[model samples]
Target: MPKMKRGSEIPHWFPLDVAGTIYPSARTRNWNYTYRSGFLLKEEVNPGLLRQALEDIHSRFPSFFVGVRNGLFWYYLERMENLDIVRRESTYPCRPMNIFSRQSPAIRILYDHRRFCLEIAHCVADGGATLTMAKALLARYLQLTGKEIPPDSGLTDLTEPPKPEELTDSYREFYVKKVGKPAPDANAWQYRPPQVLNYLKVIHGILPLEDVLPAAKARGITLTDYLMAVYLYAFYLAVPKSRRSSRQIKVSVPISLRNFFPTETLRNFSLFTNIGFDPRAKADFSFDDVLEAVKGKLAAAKTKEAMQKLLSSNVAMIQNPLVRLIPNVLKRRVLQIGYVLAGENKFTTPMTNLGRVTLPPGVAEHVEQVEGILGGSAQKRINCAMISDERFLHIYFSGDTKRTEVQREFFRLLAREGIRARVECNIREEEDVE
Candidate 1:
């Protein structure tokens, strides 16, 4: 790993990673790409102890505690000093963050009752990195509360000094020139419902792993592949029959580079592969058909070589001399346009599975559950994200539209496969209102 200043000696400002560069420009007046992941503890949260725990682990994850600043030619992260970090839980998850504010921290630490939530801007880090920090914070909080949790359970040791590799930009480090970029994709079919201003409805399905794993194993496919197939099929059922044959339905699956590369950088280091089927081509696509398509695409796209090409393409954009020289003001517009044309427009929705989460033997006993939520955007109005604990997989579907057809169909499909999920939501119907 490349070495750099550690702990208090680390620099206060640095450039955003290859993946981080686009998020700053993609933000609208009301939204940006932010996500939430948190833990449900066995006991109610103690505000004073949670605050103290954050302060204790604050210096360890320096990359996450900084604010976004505009340089003449680019956006960079500047460490915010003496800023308050923790807050009371809001009614909704992944609310738009004010990263433009000088004093705003890069991540939000929120707690409610027994839940400890971390909301992170995509520019600062990806889900994998956020989980690392969450593990550390939870461990420290438990330790402060008189638990004997070991740091070995994927938790960063607060006693040890921070590693330089943890703050490095792994995407740039692993970028390989001369790799051919992947073929372009067509615009995907998206579900559009009337918007609910400033409102986000979150629905969670708690699926038992024992019930779900056998279904995936029986198909000889990974859990992610199975879930992606289910997600796509759900969208397929929701599409109007008239447009089903012509419209292409795609779900973007994010792959963590850490799986293919050797690095521990907590910053964003992942790429997405769009997987779906064209009904025009398949004619009579079945659930099995969707699963086969997802498995095949994932098998080809998840390789190190394919990811290298995607990573190189992203890095090459930032390296362009002309692109780098464009003033920040104009660059933001160009990037936003590029995002619509090359990013969200190409995928119907994103389904990110953070995989199984484990805790120390002692910590495990105190944790009740773990969950993650992918915030919806203007274009991708509904998004899905999930994380699994020892016994159950918690899937959260968050949407800003008034419709729940897609979310309903997703869990319903799982149920048909004999995989029962305990479903819950935050929305109160109009009739329920006083």
Candidate 2:
């Protein structure tokens, strides 16, 4: 096995793996997703203990310590000089978990400037991997602190993971190939608010996950319905009169396909379901009535036909090899047109309910709670995320700087409605970095 390299070898391979010859594997390309959280440590983070934790991280997701390419997806698994993995450190800058993870490897760890806050980036693991790493680290901390026993680490339960063939290979093929697109030289996203006075931004705040559902029960709606109502209502009110006088607006709510598909793996497994509100119908409606409509839309988005059609669209794309390789430039152009056609007619924001996080018991000694943030390539419309624990909800709002003010206000409005939500800003300029 080759040793761990210090930096990423972007030229390692293309359209195949460097580690081995290409196989007709239907697995998705190793895409990158950033998941990070902040937590307080009762004590200072000891370099030694932290180092041990980093090694522990490697034991499970070691592939993260190495680089990946279109074909071969692995690091030299052998140890170098009995001290380090092959091709150890290159030139990636130092991150929070610099000792075990690469500064520029597929994965990274960064520290929050102000506190013992740790932010980890999992280039390989998706949202599911983030949760897994967080749980593992939390549990290890408990052990280091001498607080609790090791949490259950069993994955032998052969019950989950969707069947591979069942996945829409077309979606997998498209998503990765799209990544190969040569991003603009500036790397800056282009977006203009509908108008100066009319802006749509993410609202951040935590609501008791338990409270949300119970509150819905009282109102005879599901938690998803109640939250959707709030989001759609806020969005409708924000529409400029110029636009309000015209068409409908919809929100792209994402639904996870974990259960629907037999696979429970960390692979990308989500589909967007657009929900729209007709101003004519909603303008005269009360919040309760809107809630009912939201509930109905949520129900319809999950029907067998909805998913089947979506799958068909994705699968159809894979059947065209020529279309898949039309160069990233052409693909971006296609996407731009597609985005235009989709219009701003759907939901103005993306709200993802990570749902209540349940970790294996005894992991983080004296466990508190775990929450995360969701940021995307687009700098416009904020991506709002909420994850709940037994009592508290962790809400994260992230978007381009242009949307900050509105995001804060949205949280304030939620609190005004007596929902007991707290907004925490993760702005680098505003907050002290660790």
Candidate 3:
């Protein structure tokens, strides 16, 4: 690691984590593989105040105040010449970050009316870290606008110095050697939703947590497990019986590494478990069966001991001497091949739950909702992300598919079970995209 002084400020650079190294090589024009998160405020945004807030926020998070640079061996992050300036919102979310361009920031902020959105390149961080940064930016912007945010509140401050532990690659700290690795899931049946030109449908269902939590509790499973069951059931309904084969139906559930490890570093510090159900074995596959299957798979896969092996295996590959000696050109070629062979094709779709976001009283009063939107994966058309505040869980369905069958079936399942569901989308009667 090297730091340089340009006048009064010193900038720092770092190596990408084991997971992050895949993104630079794996990204394509269609599947940019980025994500966006934002909060809907009661009042409109003030760009001048927001710009100042971003500068302050960037200063506190040096890990994000950098750009991707290709090193002789591996790619690394170097400080950007100019910190990002806030811009207005775009028609759609999760646009790719052109990290190779000197003008672009790895993470950019967009604002329009009452919404403040952060579109982050996956290389910088995952949902947990990105949401943490979003809340901090919001809190700081509100304070600048003459609102009083309490010191005792859980909101992080812009004035606090960056802690060393916060910038650590936690995988390195938590890794331990293991005998074997988890086997990849068998090929799964994919949902190939019909596609429209120049448009991606983003439908959100804002339902009361009170309505959904009970159903999850009644089945003796966590909220995530219950929702995943709903997703699997939804897939079962959407796909034609003729198209479905003996292939398993799997959903990639991203698990936050913070739960098992002790660290606050905001880099890519999460792993996923691909939980699947094999419909071929049983003639009658009920929702109860789906729920039980999900619960069993999660229990077996998400244990601390299991995750330790996973971390160890991934880090071992990155740290391998033969892998390290390979040039960047050859390394990228190998990664690109691996991505196609064992990437999104192996899982049906990705399902991420951002849990709940708690805000300070000042910030909470004006904030109505928060949303996490995942970019589409290759060939895999539909992806789901959810975020919750005090009132409702906002579930976003992001895809280029023409049909809304998955969204319709999933929410209808909830509605039939006594949960209130409302549908909203970004499409107009006539016009579409940019």
Candidate 4:
């Protein structure tokens, strides 16, 4: 590994990515848009070695090792010198972060028993970047434990200096002038059950990938398409029949631009499209009906041309002269109102699939499970994220509502299809028992 440098020696500040600009403004005292990505190892974690690994790998990921700062017109990132941020899990995963405090880093390195997790603020980076950092950290941790993990794309080699390309904000790089912005979406149906203040209930449905993969293939759709269909169907079943026609049941699925654009930037490079149908329009929609709708929406939205328009729309907003002239103080309020008017309310729930996670043979051997967890918002109280290994696809639902009807119905639908899941949660046994 290369020797570490003092923070002053390196570039000390960075601009927020186009997608990240909205997160800081949307944050409240109690909640922020955060997500977690990490692995559950087969053996108990050693905190000493884990902390050492974090210190060892910190310099290699400059984009992630920083704190948020309030600029005159926008929020920016200022690098933090302290690397001793690892700690035992003392609170729930993806809890609110103190990003404004220079003393606090935007990312959390947490360990509990055999679980090693990275809880990151969305303002720092997107899922793809966070996953890369998590893989590198896991590899470093294992290597420190005397494991001979070979270099792979999944793991960032600590020996090399941070690349300039990894820090580029690809949105501006690829934005095209005159590209028309996509149409705005109507407000979708919201499942606002009673709140469980400050508490996030997590449920993991671990299913064999073999069963799930064939199920998707049999339907002639991708795994994401299959899951989105089941998710919409679950909502249809969970909600009362009387309320089904209230509004569209839209699910926001984030599409990584790395798949479409040629960029290695670790910053946020993704945009989400709302995929759903109006229950009023399709009065008697079946599973097959929902699957076909999801497929059509995904097919249209996932194309390079469609994504470029969406990306340009986002970049265009920030580039507007009127938007740029607003001071940071009022800009916060404007952005907050804009988010409420056009953001979270437009989607009933968000489901992100990190796809298959591959680790080097040496590191994969020590890992038992890997999954991604999305944080719930005040408006969209229930959200889902999934990541899979060769054996099992781990579907995690993180919710702040008192009810679990949506989650239960989702897993039940899978069970009815002969796809069984081993369920787990953070709630008490008494509370979780049906």
Candidate 5:
């Protein structure tokens, strides 16, 4: 018999949300679609303090603490009695959550040295939701350590009950008037980078935000647009000149649904727009050409009208009686196929920018860096994720390949523009498998 930790909250079980259902149904051995988001603090994490933080935050973020359960119609969440306490990071980031067994929680709080990460299944929440949870956990951990965080530290107070709105599916609420059916990116050219070891090679390129902000401003584009252009251009450089099969070098950028719709639901409430240029244009396109094309597409897609239509169409599909009637097993199979073909396969690669991450002064003082990682897809060998703090903007490149040519070219492009990057990698120098 184990004694419950003090300040622990009663966990409640619930059904998977609209967006969550698709992830569990479509997940596979090679394509789990899992993601990791966390902060690197200035000090080593205390497992005991982190456990307390988890228990405290679980009470506040009940929506995030449950385990996955199989239902007749769909997969659901079941709250468990005990939490799998914070443990040392033993493997790669974004490993699959053992949802079928009660042994695993939907999200795992992991620590290694100064890094405290939240490895979450895509089923429970998106990056934004996870970010909020991470901030709250860090705040509570700091509070326990006698560090006083401000009242408005952007951390959710753990003393209060979970908000009713936070548990609701905001996607179904804001969506209205379905416009048109969504299409797949079957024609998108997928990159086939050389395969190396089974482990992911994550390269973190730390650069000063000031170095690239001016470059983006000079192009009259946002920083994200500028970064996207740099990546697309890097991919262009990596592509063999003779291979002109890919019509466009598409990059999938996720747009947060909270921007247009007003909702505090921590569940998945984001949509994505694939923005890129056709590389097969009559004239060989320059870097500026790619930047301008990406800028135009992203600018147009960010509008309220564009987002509403996209969300509404997705809701319409889920709301369809026909979609709901399919058996869970059959639904899983169909979704697995649909996901491989229409989902990430459409884009040459996907890049997510969490944008600028701000912390309360108390917590910010102890944080060294923050990073976000998205696993690669079947079609795309590597995916890019970005996060920025007060000092630096960190871009992480994760893939199964050993080749650093793309990463080298990417940093070189930045250096060419006076945006110097301090590069670090996980693998040892002598153990170059490639």
Candidate 6:
């Protein structure tokens, strides 16, 4: 790989929506995200293959530093332990991508010494950037084996991924406006993942994402409006009832801030709205009604006053350095407090509509598929991640393993509705990376 140009580490910084909800989430989750991408290798990987792959990546994307401050800065301690590069393990850290740490552990490491996988800290790069790293890894591995691996290319080479940030950042301040305050109520059932994996089931299926989107357009609703409506139904069902129309169901959907707001492209570029359902409109609720309501809410949220209110709500609390210095245990307690304040009646689940996936004409020839993963943390119970092309509704989720059954039932619900299904799951195993 060629060396980076002088001062090549310069980055474009943007804000991340999750950064707003600091306390009620795991440090790894609050700040960073870990995800893996791999394939059943055409052949077994030689021990040396991954080490050289990472080394080459570090050389070019070298500024992968951590603990950055002042937005655009990146700080990397140049010692071996500082970055924690593992030759045998294929582990390394760069700068923080999301609020997550830089030198984080690899998610899909050398498990069983056979399965080849890579774990990435979201802080260093968003899913789009990380997928590029995976592509580089594959290209390098192929080259090591003396195959005719093509020259310098990857995910960026695939689709003109509108820096989702570019599209949304222009309206960063308007993020929380569309989200309504939840009406008072008793809380929904909450869940947390355990140390050991024990979910009822982990299943995945693909349908035409386009099909659902058009359904929204038909109703004059946006994709998010439609999906959030689905979650509201799921939330209603998840609850044990005596139907209380007064109960509020809330959801927080991260709004990309690249194009909406003005900012350098270095940091995370996203904002989110904590939207909720008010019972006054609940008794007559149907998906269509919910869709229209969400559209209205979204429109109001994009206004300037909405953004100001969101900023005022948390600005003072976070700016207090003492808030950042509290012991993590205490911090978690405070987070729970804020979470409860948002309303015990917050949405039962989070439906993250990741919009669409744009693919270059023939990239599928190289990669059979690329799935976007959305994992839930303490602040949210369940996450529904959707990525669509013209023909497929690609969906996936990660939550408390115990919720696996719930997810399965949901998938079944989708299938019964007549969507074609193609599934892939690696959750129920003693050895996962394998």
Considering every candidate listed, which one attains the maximal lDDT? Answer: 4
Native-referenced Cα lDDT, model 6: 0.47
What local lDDT score does residue 368 receive in model 3, on the 0 to 100 scale?
Answer: 84
Clashing pairs in 4: none
lDDT of 5 by residue, 19-93 (tens): 787787776566556788998888888889899878767767777776788777778888765677477998777
Per-model TM-score, in order, reads: 0.95, 0.67, 0.94, 0.96, 0.93, 0.64
lDDT of 1 by residue, 1-434 (tens): 12223447777887999899999999998788889989999999998998888888877788888889999999999987654768888667888888877876878889999998999899999999999899888988988999987546656776666788988999889888899987788988766777775777888899999999999999999898899899998888876677553668898999999999999898999999888877676567789988877786788888988888899988998899999999999999999999989998888898898999987787889999997998768687788998999999999999887688888888889999999899888776762222
lDDT of 6 by residue, 373-402 (tens): 554344444566665644676666655444
On TM-score, the leading prediction is 4
TM-score of 2: 0.67
* Clashes per candidate (backbone, < 3 Å): 0, 31, 1, 0, 0, 47
Instruction: Please list the C-alpha lDDT of all candidates, in the order they appear.
Output: 0.86, 0.46, 0.80, 0.88, 0.80, 0.47
The count of residue-pair clashes in candidate 3 stands at 1
Instruction: Report the C-alpha lDDT of model 2 over 1-434, residue by residue, as the tens digit.
Output: 11233323322222211101111111112212244554434455454554555555443433334433321222122111121322222211112222223234534443332223234333333454456555555555456656655424542111222233322222333332222222111111122353211222223466775555666677777666677677666655444445454444455666765546555344345566766566665447556666666677778768655665565454445336665565544544554444433422333566677777765555433445555665432323456666776677776665533445445445545665567766544433444222
TM-score of 4: 0.96
TM match of model 3 to true structure: 0.94
Better of 4 and 5 by TM-score: 4
Report the Cα lDDT for residue 352, model 2: 72
Off by over 4 Å in 6: 5-51, 59-118, 121-201, 242-246, 264-266, 279-285, 302-317, 320-346, 359-362, 404-409, 412-417, 428-434
Which portions of model 1 show Cα errors greater than 4 Å?
1-7, 151-154, 243-245, 430-434
Which residue pairs of candidate 3 clash? 194-402
Candidates 2 and 4, the one with greater lDDT: 4
